[model samples]
Target: MDHTTAETQLLDAADTLFYERGIQAVGMDAIRAASGVSLKRTYQLFPSKEHLVEAVLRRRDLAIRAELEAYTSARTTPTERILAVFDYLYEWFRQPDYRGCAFINSFVELGAGSENVAEIVRTHKRAFADHIAALVAAADLPPARVGQLLILANGAMVTAAIAGSPEPAREAREAAQRLLDEGVPD
Candidate 1:
C-alpha cells in the first residue's frame, strides 16, 4: 500500500488498541498485526512507538474537536449548546465499549513518565476547557462558571466510565442547566 494508506491503517489500529487496552499494554507488534502492515513498514511510518502514540492522540484530538463543534453548533440557544456537551458524553458513555476519555486514560497511564504523553493530554484538555470558556462567555455567564462546567463535564466522564452507566452525563447535564439558570436572565 501507499505511504498515506499505510500510515492511516497503522494509526487507526494503534488508536483502537491503545484506547481499548492502553499505551503500555499494546506493543508495536500488535499494532502492526492489527493494521495488517508489516513490522518494518509500521516502524518506517512511525519511527518509534512514541511517535505512533502521539500521532494517534493528535488524530483523535482533531476528530473529537470536530465532533464537539458539530454537536454544539446544532443547538439553537447558548444554554442548549453548552448542555449538548453532556448530551454528547451521555451517548458516548452509553456505547458498549466505552471505557473513558482517551486523553485522561493516556495521561493516567503515562503522564508522570512521559512528558510527550502528558503534554498531549494537557493540550487536549486545554482545548476542551477553551471550548467551555467560549460557550460560557457566549451565554454571558460569570467567567468562573467556565471552570465549574468543565469540572462537571470531566467528573461525569470519569464517573460514568467507572460506574458503567450513562447516568452521570444526565446528572451533570441537570447541574449544568441549574448553573445556566442561575446566571441567565430569562
Candidate 2:
C-alpha cells in the first residue's frame, strides 16, 4: 500500500485498539497486526509508539469536531444547535463499541507518561469547549455557559459509559436546557 493508505490504516487500527483496550496495554505489534501493515512500515511511519498514539488522537479529534459541527449545523436556531450536541451524543453513546470519548480514554491511559498525548487530548477538549462557546454565544449567552455545557456533556459521556446506556444524553440535554433557560432574564 501507499504511504497515505498505510498511515490511514495505522491510525484507524490504533484508534480502535487504544480506545477499546487502553493505550498502555496495546503494543506496536498489535497495531501492525490490526492494521495489516508491516512492522518496518509502521516504524517508518511512526518512529515511536507515542508518535502513533498522538497521530491516532489527532485524527480522532478532527473527526469528532467535524461530526459535531455537522450535527449542530443541521439545526436552524442557536438553542437547537446547542441541544443538537447532546443529540449527537445520544446516538454516539448507543453505538455497540462506545467506550466514552477516545480522547478522555487516552488521557487517562497515557497522559501521565506522555506529554504529547496529553497535549493532543487537551487541545481536542479545548476545541470542543470553544465550539460550545460559539454556539452559546449565538444565543446571546455569556461565555461562562461554555464551561457549564462542557461539564454537562463530559459528565454525560462518563455516566453513559458506566451505566451502559444512552439515557444520560437525555438527562444532560434537559439540564443544558435548564441552564440555557436560566440564562434568560425573563
Give lDDT tens digits, candidate 1, residues 1-186.
Answer: 999999999999999999899899999999989999999999888899999988999999999999999999999998899999999999999999898999999889889988998999999999999999999898889888899999999999899889999999999999999998899445
RMSD of 2: 1.2
- Clashing residue pairs in all predictions, respectively, total 0, 0
Q: TM-score of every model?
A: 0.97, 0.96
lDDT for 15 in candidate 2 is 89
Q: In model 2, where is the ten-residue run with the lowest total lDDT?
A: 177-186
Candidate 2 TM-score over all chains jointly? 0.96
Residue 93 lDDT (model 2): 97
